[model samples]
Target chain A: MFLITNEPLSVTEVEAVVADPGAGALVTFTGVVRDNNLGKSVHYLEYEGHPPMAEKAMAQIGDEVTARWPGARVAMAHRLGRLDIGEASVIISVSTPHRADAFAACQYAIDRLKEIVPVWKKEVWEGGEYWIEGSTAAS
Target chain B: MITVQVQLFAAYREAVGARQVPFDVPQGATVLDVWQQLQATYPKLRTPRPVAAINDAYATLDTVVQPGDLIAYLPPVSGGRSLIPSPSGEG
Candidate 1:
């Protein structure tokens, strides 16, 4: 259930999508907006994404996870538009037959999402704003 | 000549001040060719070549573009939890 939406994200909703009867462990990771960054007081964050491509990238991440950890299920959702401080910007859920696989796969999903997803965040500070671009070089 | 739809996102979009633009290029023109043309038109696009995609799929800069294709120039992504600091030192 890879998604890019303007609606607020929910961990439970994402978790439900990856629920598996045979799974022994489920791991959910929620990314929330922070109030401060780089020593500046952040007012809010505006996220923009190429929806189709973002979802494709997420699905690709899921494929990678399943290949590495067979029988693992992954689900992810990313929120777009204005997000206030403490609001969840992204959620990832992974279910695996073992706890270690669930934790590792969940982490991999978020890390890969950051690398390949076509979503950008604009940080609005007290008096100014700037688009934040990740450091990873585009391959 | 082939015409392709060029899409920009994030800083690239802000730099161009538009989300989409149309470009006409000779047949066999690659993504790099379109990027050069884009930079020429919008000098503010001073950032280096970014991740490129065609018709919603990731493609190399050397990939040849097709007419009416959607070519996206994606700036460095900032989604999910980022452990690395941004180029501007503000992640």
Candidate 2:
């Protein structure tokens, strides 16, 4: 399962989507909004995404994970709109036959999501705001 | 001449002050050509080489754009967890 929503992200919901009886290990990663960036106090974050393209990119990441780690199931979700400090903005869950594969695949999923997914976040600071540039435009 | 719609996001959207832009260009114009035209029209578009997307897919500057194409000018992504530093040694 891959999605982009304006609702709050839930790790349990993401984990359930990737749960498999055959899998002995499960790993999940959640991205939370931080209060400060580069020594500047942040009020909140606003995320925007191209839903169709972002979903396609996320599904491709899941496919890549399954190809690399056999028997692995992956699910991911990214939140849109304004998110306050400590709010969960993104969640990824992976289940595999072993813990090693689960850990690696989960990490890879988030990394690939950031690299290819068409999601952008704007950091609203005390006085001003700027869009955070994570990866290069071509990445 | 061909007419294409340009979708702007993030800073690009803010710069243009509109979500979509329409351009009429020569039939053989490429994606880069549309970008050049945009720069000439909107001087506030400071990013000389913004990312381009055709029909919701990532596209190159040299990609040929067809009539009625939905071209998106995307800004850089900044929402990944990698930007955050970990308290422990492991990131």
Candidate 3:
């Protein structure tokens, strides 16, 4: 269920794809837009992505999780375009036979998604806006 | 010469003022060549090197560019709290 959409994301939708009868636990992670960043009051965020490549990267992450945790199933969805504060921007669901595996796999998915996904975000504030590059180093 | 489509996003898109552009490069030119040419054309593209993908797959800068290929130069990335956490746990 790796997906990229301009519409709002739903955790239930993503979780349904990873539902497994053998699974005892399902862990989900939702990344939401915040109102403040770097001490500036954020107005909103605009997400842009290469849809095909982004989904490819996400599916690759799922494959990694499956290989790392043999019984785990993973599904993810990421939303694009203008998103206001508190809106869900991304969701990752992982189901596994044990709670530990489900939790670990779910965290790993989000971390890898941030690292490899071909998506970018722009933070717009009251007076200005800046593209977030996810690097702390000066650009 | 070969022509490839260069896709830019985020800062790269704003810097170049175009979402995508068609570029011409000599045969056997690598992705690095395309980056250099873009830098020469748009000095505002300040990032020295960014991750590149060829035809929707991750590629090294040295990877050869193919005619009609869709090449994307990604700025860092977004989402997640922080890319690097402080070792000392103090800001």
Candidate that scores best on DockQ = 3
lDDT of 3 by residue, B1-91 (tens): 9999999988999999999999999999999999999999999988776778888777888999889999998887765433222233222
Q: What C-alpha lDDT does candidate 1 achieve relative to the native structure?
A: 0.85
Kindly list the per-residue Cα lDDT of model 3 for residues A1-139, writing each as its tens digit: 9999999999889999999999999999999998988778889999999999889878888888898899999999999999999999999999999999999898888888887777788889988999887664121
lDDT of 1 by residue, A1-139 (tens): 9999999888888999989999999999998899988778889999999999888778878888898899999999999999999999999999999999999998888878886677889989988998887643221
lDDT of each: 0.85, 0.84, 0.86
Under CAPRI classification, how is model 3 graded?
acceptable
Write one digit per residue (lDDT tens) for candidate 2, span A1-139. Answer: 8999999988888999988999999999998888987778889989988888889878888888898899999999999999999999899999999999999999988877786788898889878998878542222
Q: Which stretches of candidate 3 lie over 4 Å from their true place?
A: A137-139, B79-91
The local lDDT score (0 to 100) that residue B82 gets in candidate 1 is 38
Pairs that collide in candidate 3 are: none
Candidate 1 deviant stretches above 4 angstroms = A136-139, B79-91
| Best prediction by lDDT | 3
- Per-candidate DockQ vs. reference: 0.34, 0.31, 0.36
**TM-score for all models, in order of appearance:** 0.88, 0.89, 0.89
**Alpha-carbon error at B18 in model 3, in Å?**
1.0
Query: What's the TM for model 3?
Result: 0.89
The 10 consecutive residues of candidate 3 chain B with the worst lDDT sum are B82-91
Q: How many residue pairs clash in all the candidates, one count each?
A: 0, 1, 0
